[model samples]
Target: MRESDLIYILAMAGVTYLVRMLPLVLLKKEIKNRFLRSFLYYVPYACLAAMTVPAVFFATTYVLGAAVGFFVALFLSYREKSLLVVALAACAAVFVAERLIQWIA
Candidate 1:
């Protein structure tokens, strides 16, 4: 609402845009290194896991429920199940585990 807040937000937006855009604009040529290219390719997945893994543990009230869901998802993924199936299976596992825990407690 204030002029100073608007200026600060614009400054932050400009900095973020430049940080993301500069790499693409400056590196006009394709990356050629096998190791570096591979690493770059996996950065998004690594970031995603880093962000998601922590939240998954706290998704349920019971840690055991979350752990069961995580293991079910991992097992399904390891078996090469489709993403939808893996997600559904993990949710189901967590739901069942949580219900069991609630009933016991």
Candidate 2:
């Protein structure tokens, strides 16, 4: 790899490490503030969804299929379905939607 690429990678690693480490180092005591604790509890889920939702829309060949899959997954999850069930149902929805769209087009 190029020197510039190596430098960029090292910088990224250092930043990521610092971001993770600083929180642990700074928050030595258990956070007792109810609001802060609640907010922190949901932070990981919010971050995951923020990162994942956009990719879901672009991952499929057609946006329509992805939308169908996303809604199916959302519905199943809202109903408290098992992760495997939700995943399979979403995949099936996407597959069927894509096929229908392809056939129609």
Candidate 3:
């Protein structure tokens, strides 16, 4: 809306890009240490769990509904395990649940 807000947003965007790019630019070489590389492998799972577990419970029943959808997706994707299928299942579950609730209330 204002010039100050635009400058602040641009500055933040630049900072975020620099922070993310710095790691890739710096770690261009393959890590030699086996232990460290092994540890790095868990980083994605750990970060996702850390971010999601708390939010799942803190948020609404949507999380539980998503869990149901995840299972459904898992089953539907049992042979191929496609990400698209999983995402569709989760979104469909949300939409159906909301509509069902509205009809009931």
Candidate 4:
């Protein structure tokens, strides 16, 4: 790669390393605040959803199919379905919705 690209990658790596290392270096003791602890516990899930939810809508051939899939996945997950079941059901929902849309068009 070009020198500029290498510099950008190293800069990104340094920033990422600092972000993780600073937290560990600064928070040496176990966090004891109940509210803060609870919030921290959910941070990873919140971050994951924040990253994943938007991509779900745009990753499919059609927004309508993706929406149908998202709802099905949401419903299944809300009902505490297994991960595999939720994923498969969502995929099936998307497939059916896309096919229906295609057929009707």
Query: Candidates' lDDT values, in order?
Result: 0.95, 0.96, 0.74, 0.96
Find the candidate with the highest TM-score and give its number: 3
Estimate, for each residue in 1-105, the C-alpha lDDT of model 1 and write its tens digit: 999999999999999999999999999999999998999999999998998888889988888999999999999999999999999999999999999999999
* lDDT string, candidate 2, 6-103, tens digits: 99999999999999999899989998999999999999999989987889999999999999999999999999999999999999999999999999
lDDT string for model 4 (1-105, tens) is 799999999999999999999989998999999999999999999998998788999989999999999999999999999999999999999999999999998
What TM-score, computed on C-alpha atoms, does each candidate reach? 0.66, 0.74, 0.75, 0.70
Report the Cα lDDT for candidate 1.
Answer: 0.95
Off by over 4 Å in 4: 42-55
Among residues 3 or more apart in sequence or in different chains, the pairs in candidate 2 whose N, CA or C atoms overlap within 3 Å are: none
Error of 4 at 80 (Å): 1.4
Q: Order of all candidates by TM-score, from best down to worst?
A: 3, 2, 4, 1
True-structure lDDT of candidate 4: 0.96
Provide the RMSD of all predictions against the true structure, rounded to 1 decimal.
3.2, 2.6, 2.8, 2.8
TM-score of 3: 0.75
Candidate 4, run of 10 with poorest lDDT:
51-60
Better of 1 and 2 by lDDT: 2
